[model samples]
Structure formats: structure tokens, C-alpha cells
Target: MKEIQAVKSSLNAVFAIKDLGQLHFSLGLEIAKTKKGIHVCQRKYALEILADAGMAGAKPVSTPMVKKNEKLFEQVVMHDVSAYRRIIGRLLYLVNTRPDISFIVKCLSQFVQAPTKQHHQAAQGILRYIKSSPAQGIFDPKDTDIQIKAFSDSDWASCILTRRSITGFCIFLGESLISWKTKKQNTVSRSSFEAEYRALAATCCEVQWVTFLLEDLDISVHHININCFKVP
Candidate 1:
């Protein structure tokens, strides 16, 4: 507390700055400090998005995307391209807190150039899913083991058009999730084993980058765990 105040005072001397006692909200993120830990979310931002999309009263779904058999990339093009692009931009920002929707968002993002009606409907499905848990956010627990662990997986040739594998991974600092990503691989893989190997390789690169980040922050990462699924 004293160190923070000292820094604030030093900054205030040179420039006009008011010391906000504690951070509760900033840049659309709602931060709440609780006895358990710090909980961060964007509930208000999410609600606004629902309202903008005219899905405020839409029924919520359990999942963000339909099953693999349901085609998301139909040839029927949407008329209002701008609207679809806007919603996708918002959802991408929301992915900062909602990792569950990351994979579907990645899939939907690919069709932004020439989005179809199916693509718009798929994007709306995401809105409905967000409506289910608008307040959902990442909780950083107070009690933690202070370790880093990551899990990664891949689906071979998931993209119907390109036949490229999609890679998904999440990194955890102790029990709290800190970072995650879902991306379509640039090249197609010959086998499922090759796809999974690529996923693990991507995960390793992410872990290495995260370790370097921690080192820069002066936080020692004693133990690091990177786990991937086995292809049977």
C-alpha cells in the first residue's frame, strides 16, 4: 500500500492525476475483489452486446456451436455484412473472459470476409450462449500453489474447406486460467498423430513465451506442466 501511494505521489507531482483508491472497473472489464480472490468479468459489456444484436430476450443455449455435421459455412451470403462483422468484433473482445466460446469464435471469424446467413445465425448462437452466463468470468483464487500448467488438443482436418486442423489450448496459473487460444493451423496434417503433435508444439511455444513473461515480471515459475491428449 505504501509503495503504491509513493508511486502515485511521484506521478502526481509531474502530472495531474487523481488516485483512485482501488480499481473496480476499467476498459469494459468489471473487477471485483472478494475474500476468495479477484473476480474479473464484462457482464455489462455482454448485456449491451445482446441488446445491440436484438437478442436480449433470446433463449440461451448450452453450447456455442452446433455439432460437426451441421454446416456453418454455407454458400448463402448475408446481406448485412457490417452487422455480422460488428458482433464478431465484440465477441472477440469478450473472449478475454469467456474461453468456452473461443473455438466457435475462431471458426466464425474465418467467414467475416463473405459471411453467410448460416454464419450470422452461428454468431447469434454465440450471443444466446453468452446470455446464459453473462456474469461468468475468471476467478483468481487467493490460495494458490503458484505453479503453471497447460492443456492442449487438436481436431484433424476439422475445416471442411481447407482441411486444416484446429489447435486449442489453455494455460493456468495455479487453479486459475490466465491465457487460452483457438486457431486453425496453416497447413493440413496427414494423420491425427501429426495434428496432435502440432498442437503440443504450439502449446510448448506458448508455455515458453509465458515463462519469459513471468521472468520479466520478476515472478519465478518453479514448476511448469504441459499436458496433451493421446491419440488412440
Candidate 2:
């Protein structure tokens, strides 16, 4: 408080500032304080997405993508491609608080330029899954070690159209998930080993950036562990 007041006093001559007390919402994310830890979710934003998709009362599904290996490129083109794009865009933002949808969203994003009816159905599947638990979010426990760990994997030539590999990774700051990604590789790998190596490289780059960020915040990472899960 004293430090904040001192900074405010110094800045008073230049600019006016108002105390917001605490962070409640920012860029569609909802924040709340709890006994366990800080609760962060986008329940309101999620419901808005469901309503926008016209799936407000749709039946929930046990999983986001039931048929992960289904051929996405062979489907018929969607008449309303903009709707699919909009839903994918919204899902991208929702991934900020819901990492569970990352992989599916990443897959769906590939068809943003020319989405099909099959793509729309897959997106609706995501909405149905969200309907099951709109309030689900990441929980950051207060008490945690200053450790950084990550795991990465890749599916070689997953995309039928481009034959590009898909890579997924998750990073944890202690026991709390801090970052994750599911992205298509820019280049095609000849073999699974090459794809996995590319995934590892991408994960390493992310970890390096995160390490620098934590250092800027004066938080030293004590333990670092990285595991690459190979798919046989």
C-alpha cells in the first residue's frame, strides 16, 4: 500500500489515477477471490458464446470432439462460412480460461478460410461440451513451489489437406497451468520423430519466453522439468 501511495504521489503531478480496488473482469475474463486461491473463469462470456451460437439450451456432450480422427477436409462447404469463422474466433478467446477446448479450437481454426458443414458440426460439438460446464476454469493454488515444467506431443501429418503435423503442449508454473497451445506445424515432417522434435523445439521456445517473463517479475524458477510424450 505504501509503495502504491508513493508511486501515486509521484504520478499525481503528471496524471490522475483511480484505484479499481481489485480485478473483476478484463478482456472477457472473470476474476474472483476464494479461500482456495484466485478463481478465474469466463462463465458469462461462455454463456454469451452459447447464446450467440444458438445453442443456449443444447444438450451437453461428454467430450468436445467425439470423432477426433474424422476427415475434416472431405466435407461439404458451409453456406454460411462467416458463422463458422465467428464461432471459431469466439472459441479462440474462450480458450483463455478454458484450455480443454484448445485442441479442438485449433483444429477448427484450420478451416476458417473455407469452412464446411462438417466443420460447423464440429464447432457445435464444442458448444455442446461447453454447455456441460460453462463455469469451468483454471485454479491457481496460492501455496506452490517455484517450479516450471512442461509436456509436449505431436501428431504427424494430422491434417489431410495439407498433411501438416499438429503439436500440443502445456506449461505449468508449479501445479498451476500457466500456458498451453495447440498449433499446426509450419513445415511437414517426414517422420514422427521429426514431428516430435519440432514440437519439442516449439515448447522450448515457449518455455524460454515464459522463463524470461517470470524473471522480469522477480520470480526465479527453481526446478525445471520437461517431458515429451511420443505417440507410437
Candidate 3:
């Protein structure tokens, strides 16, 4: 704590700063410190989103998205494109603390330029899901072990319009999830194996970056488990 105080004191000496005492809320994220860990969420921000969409009392859904169907591919453009784009932008920010919604947000982001009625509906479904658990967020345990693990997966040709693959992965520090991403691959994969390989390669790069980061922080990573599905 003294080291942190000294750094803060030095910064204060050089630049004007106000001590916030403790982090409870910042940039839409709400932090709660506990004996188990530090929990972070955006319940208030989520509520605001729901209120903006006039879905404050909408029925909650178990899943953020529905099964892929023909309706989703229809090019019937939405009348108000800006509203859809604004919702998507807010949801993108919400993904910072909601990993469960990461893939869906990535999927919806593709339609921002020309969102359709179906796309707008899908975005609203995500809001309904958010209503289910507005307080859901990542937890960093206080007694977490110094171990790194990652899991990677890919869906071959999941994009109906482009036939491109989507890569998703999550990295864990002990039992706490620290980093995750859901991204569409730039090129199309010929086979599932190729898709899986790309996802695994992306995950490996993230692991390497994370290991270097830990080393910089003087935290030695003795065990790193990078797990992926066996390619057939």
C-alpha cells in the first residue's frame, strides 16, 4: 500500500489530482469489493439502456439470441438506422463486463452500417436478456492462484452473408476470467479444422502477450494451459 501511496503522492506533486478513496463506479462500471473478490458490473448503465429502449419491464429471456433462421437474412432495412446503431454502440460498451453477450454483440455489430428490422429485433432480444441479470459481471477472486489457462473455439462459416468463420476465446487467471474476445475471421476457412486452427493460433498469441504482461508485472507464470478442441 505504501508503494501505491508513494506513486500517488509523486503523481499528485507533479499534476493536480483528487483521491477518490475507492473505486465504486467509473466509466459505466460499478465495482464492489468483497472478501471473496472484486465484482464489477454495469447494472445502472444497463438499466439506462433498457429505459432508453422503453423495455424497462420487458420479459427476460434465457438467451441473448435466437436460433439462426431465414428471417434474419432478409434485407428489409430498418426505417430508423440511427436508433439501432446507438443501441449496438451501447451494447458494445456493455460487453466490457458481460462476456456472455460478447459473441452476440460481435454478430450484431456487423449490421451497424445497414441494420434490418430483424437485426433490430435481435438487438432488442439482447436487451431482454440483459434484464434477466443486470448485475451479472466478472469476479476476480482475492485468493486466486498464479496460473493462466485459455480455451478457444470457432464456428465454421457461421456468417450467413459472408460465409466467414467466427473465433471466440477466453483466458482465465486461476478461476477468474480476465480476457475474452469474439471476432469474425478475415478470410473464409475451407474446413472446420482450418477454422479451429485459426482460433487456436489467435488464442496462442493472446496467451503469449499475457505471459509477457505478467512477466513485466514480476508475476512468474509457471503453468499455462491452452486448451482447444481436437481437430478431425
Task: Give candidate 3 misplaced runs (Cα > 4 Å).
Answer: none
Write down the RMSD of all candidates, one decimal each.
1.2, 1.6, 1.2
Candidate 1 versus the native: TM-score?
Answer: 0.96
Q: After superposition, how far is residue 159 of candidate 1 from its true place, in Å?
A: 0.5
lDDT (tens digit, per residue) of candidate 2 on 1-232: 9998899888887888777788999888899987778889999999999999899989999899987666577667777798899999999999998999999898889789888888888999999999999999989998889999999999999888788999999999998999999999999999999999999999999999999999999999998899999658
Per-model C-alpha lDDT, please? 0.91, 0.91, 0.93
Model 3, C-alpha of 171: deviation from truth (Å):
0.5
Name model 2 segments beyond 4 Å from true. 10-12, 69-71
Candidate 3 overall lDDT versus native:
0.93
How far off is residue 124 in model 2, in Å?
0.9
